[model samples]
Target: MSQRSIKITMSAVLLAAATLASTAPAGAAHGGEPLTDVRVATHFDLAAGQMPENITLLPDGTAAVTFAAGRQVALVSPGGGTRILATLPAPADGGVHTPVLGFPLTTGIARTPDGTVYVLYATGTADLTGLWRLRPGQDPQRIAALPADGLPNGLALDAHGRTLYITDSVLGTVWTVPTTGGTPTAWSTASELAPTGFLGANGAKVRGGALWVTNLDRGTLLRIPIRSGNRAGAPQVKASGMAGIDDFAFTGRGNEVLAALNAPNTVVRIRPDGTSTTVLDAADGLQNPTSVALRGKDVYVLSAAYTTAADPNLLRAHLRGHR
Candidate 1:
């Protein structure tokens, strides 16, 4: 890979480090040419050098973004006003806390229909890695702890709000934990999930009675059927060669997904038939797009721009051929 590709990969790894460490929305989606008419809804203070990683939509149409290096989560209003929601602690200094790849990364954040917020942060120390729950006017609660060597990234919860699925990017493992509080157990350990580079299993979402995941190093998207008893059945490749794939959201179209390709700085509309078309790309002002989320008819993208002098940005744009 070229130097630019290397930088993008590093940024993705660091951002992924956060999700592997926390871990969008719906709309009528269509595939077409790249979307160039993008608008920036918010931009962080360039001097802060904050890297905004993954994003989850709030029930009221606002957004919450994770700042990996900053160790905090912020709420961004629909009109772009931002306020800090919570500040996370650094690792407790036990196993290993290194920042050669990235430091203080907050990987993923999710919100349920009931307005409860869940966040994953890389404590760097083994036992310090935590998945936390933040309720209204309450201190964050530690729900569960992941493995020392594992980087817990993407997150998904069942409809009944009883079970939660977390993806480990470094170890390429999927873990299961009870929302009511319990130990996290391995849900799936298929060989296909083995890490090929800096990351393995990353973003995840529950749809169509299964859990969908993307592998960063291998650039493959896989689905593991969720059996009747919440057991993960055999795995299947949904799409491949989607290099640098990070997080994605389902479109209104059957089995179609809007995927964020981090290294290439683009978002693609992957069809049910496993084909993909660019919806927005580098030329469309995407500078390392890390996450995408939808609220009603609007689609929002979070671009980290890790290599740029400008601060990270969140852009709002229309999905080509969707409106």
Candidate 2:
């Protein structure tokens, strides 16, 4: 990957890592030619009624899907599909109570390099519900929480996994927290960035010298230079052509951002210069796809419904209402 592409995708450092690690050069991850079609590499079918809010791949390559309806996080395997794991109850530690700012309406998820899983839920009692660290044989512990109305939308980690990036939709800001012990501190405030304000801070990634964030209400993607933990100066929008944009991933060599649009059940591949092409029209294997998770060349999409061919209503609806 080229320096600019790496900087664009993960942050410039990741670009350096890629170049030092490989000799593919600039035009590698970027499509060598104009791209066409939304490729369906694999489809792992799950239960029809179970909706997945967020997804993360385990160390063993197993995929974990967070459920919106139950106390169980579904452990999905190739053949087993989904095995319910009881949501470990929060334990009391000393007199130091980890505030349950938002529990149970779990949305954000991240993992350390060692496979420790951190899941955030809306704590029913306060602004934050629960922050749980799930380690094998270790009872889940509530480490941190966010405000009740403060929705934690995106989660990302550094190369070493010590630092975590989180987005606060209600506050329209981003935070950097230590994976070990610490109250999440402000990393960047939206007001300092030009365009002045953010609609809703949704998804985030600290990869390759840039910090990539998703602004849901604004239907845009943003980038900021990474220096230590500070976002410092203003951030720039990488792309702004989707409606109801929620989450995005750096896939296909880091030049493309695949965004899952909520309304028309669509996913679009956007370029670095803000141009976009609808890879999956609402009629193509999508139905209110809330999130898109990438694992290598495959993509796991969470949707409220399914999209099908022989459908004018689905595709036309997106043409009129979305990007």
Candidate 3:
């Protein structure tokens, strides 16, 4: 073993390392996709400093985003730009934002056909959280508010917009409230329809008469019927094995759904039957992405909290509209 031999061995080891890196899937650490594109879809980056709690798409190619810690709402462009909307009130102010909501939580957001915006807030207090509605010009309103002793999160509308379905993470179930804003009827009042354990049921959206849910820890996608009792059926696992998924969106009538994998920061497309493929990877697709929304070909993702002990500034990415 002389100098020449040592040098040759070192070179060989370096080459092997590079080869392995090239072949490995992106987001392998958290189980997600690889980086590929550079389409900073939004105009402003919300990736680093702000913790995006949730995002909902608007028809005009924009999206409403909620920052959990900042307690602010943002109107995000189809590409990657962001505009801050109104902040929400605390439960002390009568709106949902109490014990029931998860910690540092933005919870969820939804929009009505008439352009009414509703954002769900959790106060970390089990009994004080519910829903907050914001109109175009007036102060925000609270619709379908729960009793001071209840919890609510993950909001969704039925196929016809008649009912709003919500998932309570702590309660481990989904509930429905009428559109006119009255007492909420338990959509799946029975525990049999709700999942349990590492199933991690959260982030629900109704599409095509079915409910789509993101399983927080187990890394899965779940589907359940909106109607309960005789009309309600047991929940099923629609898709599974995702990477820290948070939110997802489906094309108007297409079978494709783009799911957000938050931890590794990526997006993946899954078919109606549960097969999936990587559409966006972490290194390139996003950084700490929390939620996703789609209108036509455009896909919107919110990048939350990329800053570290070395960096404190915020960051974000906006992918252009896709068909």
* Cα RMSD to the true fold for all candidates: 6.0, 13.0, 11.2
Consecutive 10-residue window with the lowest summed lDDT within model 1: 21-30
TM-score of 3: 0.73
Candidate 3 lDDT: 0.58
Better of 2 and 3 by TM-score: 3
CA lDDT, every prediction?
0.73, 0.54, 0.58
Please provide, for model 3 over 80-108, each residue's C-alpha lDDT reduced to its tens digit, 9 standing for 90 to 100. 46677777655444333343222334568
Q: Deviation in angstroms for 181 in model 3?
A: 2.0
Q: Report how far residue 173 has shifted in candidate 2, in Å.
A: 1.6
Worst 10 residues of 2 by lDDT: 309-318
- Highest lDDT model number: 1
Misplaced by over 4 Å in model 3 are 1-38, 43-49, 77-81, 91-104, 126-128, 147-151, 189-199, 227-231, 306-323
Candidate 2 residue lDDT tens string, 132-183: 5777667667676655445566777777778777777656767777788467
Compute the lDDT for candidate 2. 0.54
Ranking of all predicted structures according to lDDT, beginning with the best and ending with the worst: 1, 3, 2
TM-score for each prediction? 0.86, 0.70, 0.73
